[model samples]
Target: MPDRLDPKRQFLADLFDAAVAAADPRRILQDVLPPPPKGRTVVIGAGKGAAQLAQALEALWPHPCEGAVVTRYGYAAPCRHIRVLEAAHPVPDAAGIEAARVLQSCVADLGPDDQVIALICGGGSSLLPAPPEGLTLEDLQELNSALLASGAPISVMNDIRKQFSTVNGGRLAALAHPAPVLSLIVSDVPGDDPGAVASGPTVPGRPAASAVLAEVTARGLELPPRAMAFLQAAAEQAPAAPPPSRSTTRIIASAALSLDAAAQRARARGVNAWVLSDAIEGEAQEVALVHAALARQAQHSGFPHPAPLVLLSGGETTVTLRHKGRGGRNSAFALSLALALEGQAGITALAADTDGIDGSEDNAGAFVDGASAAAMRAAGVDPRRLLQGNDAYAAFDAVDDLFHTGPTGTNVNDFRAILLGELPDG
Candidate 1:
């Protein structure tokens, strides 16, 4: 590839790749070792990165091990001893229910002499769904659909999920008590709060069910009767998560680490890299507008430094789906920013999920340029109308700018970068 290609475009792509690589399970699992116990070691986990993490453990662990891990469909990796199971993500399915059963069975026989390495990451909460008492999988499925459509933040959504699942809310750790657990996490939540990541399958902390119900009700979400009953029962039995014991909890990867790696890559490519924040949260469109304002300030006043700088950020932003949009929050943010930029010259950006799936769409996110408005106009696509419908993926696809990278097998939330200058012409 020639360096003469638009710097704004090239820098954004490079930064996204750097962020994805930083969250790769192979790289993050190297430092996670506590010497295999004398007894058998069981590897059980669930997430988009669960299979890959299991594979890494199989490759690196010195002792004999056996277990199972469930990952999102098509995200599984080859592994011996640790069986890899595929399941639906963003929704609980029969396969997920089966995998949860297998996970429970894997730990059922372990005693204090045994060790359980829980390879947790984003999507695990849904992937390992074992509905709580008085709740059926059908009820869970309906509640999950409502939450996904509600556009609640991941923290709140996971809080709600923890209340309905048998394996979440530190229940997994409680179930495997006396068997020293080592949780190696790939954080996808803001602040890398273990309790919020995959509903803290292994970590020991959780909010009460009433608090979760209050948030859901406040958001105007209508829960199914069975789900409501389950929540009511849970609220009555609401107990805080147990204190953290000797179970070693380690955050092997997170948005901050991914953002830092991206910054270094931008600097290596001779672009000044500035990470705005790793804990960004809010509605996707609003977040995009805020970032656009900062970009405009950097362009006009150079308060945050001159052009040729790449602004980087990592965080999971939500999209309240008022309309029947066909895109994820990352793409929504990109489209919102593109419209705000309104053909401003010498600027290009990309927003993508590190897990390689933005929302329910196949593409990670989308790329936008100074010419986006012009291109959309020429294509007869109204950006405002699309934004209103929450159809950013369709808008970007029309412009041939959707960035697709199938299932990177990791999730650290979203990676975004904006480039603010043109490269030297060839």
Candidate 2:
């Protein structure tokens, strides 16, 4: 793609790289680590950034460190002491089931003098799949698949996740009783809710379990009978585990910082870059329409920013699986944006997940420019039709424009950039 002959493509790619660098765990973890305790220090985490966060902690601590972290397959970072385990993401697997159990056991038998430093980020809820008692891993997997298919928002999804996890919803941190816990979270969910990131393994979840179950039922998600009963019983029988205040939770990386970094880079290159927001969320296709509309306005009227403007944003987007396609949220959004742009000239946009995988797909996302529509037409591919089937990956793949950056070791959520250049010689 580097030789695609688009003048703006390289710059856009650089902008994305800058954003990823800003949220890299290795750099952010350098300053936020709690001073090494005199006693044993245990490192634990689950997410796309878990391994990277653990590796950074191992590098900085003054004494010995031990524990484990679970990340999506192809996302593990090399570590000498901390165990890095790979697992399926956006859906849980037996490997994650075991890892979550190990995580719980890792914190067990700890003395009051011990310290636990947990690293968590996006994709964590799926990475650490520990089902509560009375529910099987199959039950949790079926529930997760339902949630992903339902296209529900992260906030709602996490609320339900915390209800069934043995280690999540503050249970993991609660294990560190007497032992102080320090959690360094890289925010992917909007508002940076600690309990939602990786299902809040170290932090308590919000929106009471009963409320989450209600939201899930409202969305028509079908949980396994046992899973459904467990959640219902949990809500009816047990009170919402009071949110945990015991852990020292700090957000060291987030979408806002990454967007700021990208915007700064754009400005350095002499372009007018504006960050729309770091908290944007909604259905991927719907959100793409809004962004496309904004880009068109910038092209016609330059209302918010001038020509040569780059509208940037970061946040998670949902994709409800009606037709059951392979594309992730970013690809779906890119395809929708491309169709809406309708081959408009002097405009190019990129949508990608900062963690380097947009859902379960190998490509982080895709790039759509003024030529995208034309290219698809030439290949006899109908972008709108593919989108109708929820097959965004196929649409983008036909054009050879899918952006692939494997396991970026970070998760600040989606990053989108709409670069609208000056109209040709007006």
Candidate 3:
């Protein structure tokens, strides 16, 4: 906690804070809400940001709207009118199952005069899980564990989830038939597909079961037999009726918006901020290599941008999970970049999840600079072994570079910034 006061580290932390603040549900909820309807407004959602969105909506809306929202435990925000329920994330639990049931009931019997505002965001898939009739909570827990370990992208995982969920895949919206559903989403997946965010409980469109099964086989995931049968049966069955046409969705906050905000912050400070992309996605270490190459290019040629440059990107990266120890994609990317840089001067980088949780780990992510290598070696940390074991958290923690901020209340996926210092003239 003491070294967290370091000015250089604080600068990076400040940038991350700016990015997160930009995506706050309270900030985005205002000025975007539709006019008050004549009947009741039923609010419901599931995600890491759902509770915060509910609290913000309650504060912003002039009329009374009642409903329930589920969020990852410890991520709940205070709300007087809306009910805030906490549950497990990255995996489903009984609490989440019950919450999903309650959320579905919120939309039931709602008329066209009533409205439903769904606060959807990252982590909702696991936090709002509700399995089909034949599936038990234990079964869902197993499916979640395998899919997470298989290293499939979030979109793919969500598609598989939709296949077995009685509450996901627009089923919830279908239940709310006559009501007008406005899904306000905070996207954490690449391409910002609402149908994938939180498994699209209110948004329509689910990938074909055959496609998801193919992915499972390709990824070699150990799926439950019951789950497999469910998918096969669903695939062979005729497509269900279309989802509620009255339901509409809007992305209130996303990685792109967060990246833009970070770039703007850099520009305000006179630094040349170039946003590389807001949709970069892949294996964490592999993406680090690309980022390291860009940092090196800016350091050498300054092509596309000059010195005093900060390259920013926003997206969710994956970890293959070779080792059992605690580590997340952001930390993995930072460690890999440090090794690739080999303590090269005039460059520093920070990688963190804006939600303040990276994977199942406690820390958000970490920072790397010219001193990272030496610091690790001085601390008797084997960067190569740790990286090989997918234990970047250990490397960063050894060097006191682990960035921890508890839960930031909202999520917009990962935020990475690489600062390229000006080269000394010959």
Local accuracy of candidate 2 as per-residue lDDT tens digits, 49-97: 8888888787787688999999888788899999999998877898998
Order of models, best TM-score first: 3, 2, 1
Worst 10 residues of 2 by lDDT: 237-246
lDDT of 3 at 424: 31
Clashing pairs in 3: none
Top model number, TM-score: 3
Where model 3 places Cα greater than 4 Å from the true spot, the runs are 1-4, 422-426
Candidate number that wins on TM-score, 1 or 2:
2
On residues 1-426, what C-alpha lDDT tens digit does candidate 1 reach at each position? 222435466667778888989988778888777787888888889899888888887777878999899999889899979999988878889999999898888877568888899999999888988986676788889988888877778888888887787778777777777799989989999988887888887777677878877887788777778888778777787475565444668899999999999999877877777899998999999999998988888888776767778788888898877888799999999999999898688778899999889988899998887778678878989988998898998899887888888888789999999887754343
Model 3, 109-191: lDDT tens per residue? 88889988888999988988787888889889988988777778888888899987887888888898888889999998889
Question: What is the TM-score of each predicted model, taking all chains together?
Answer: 0.95, 0.95, 0.96
Q: How many Å off is the CA of 182 in candidate 3?
A: 0.4
Greater-TM-score candidate between 2 and 3: 3
lDDT score for candidate 2 against the true structure: 0.85
Q: What is the descending lDDT order?
A: 3, 2, 1
Worst 10 residues of 3 by lDDT: 1-10
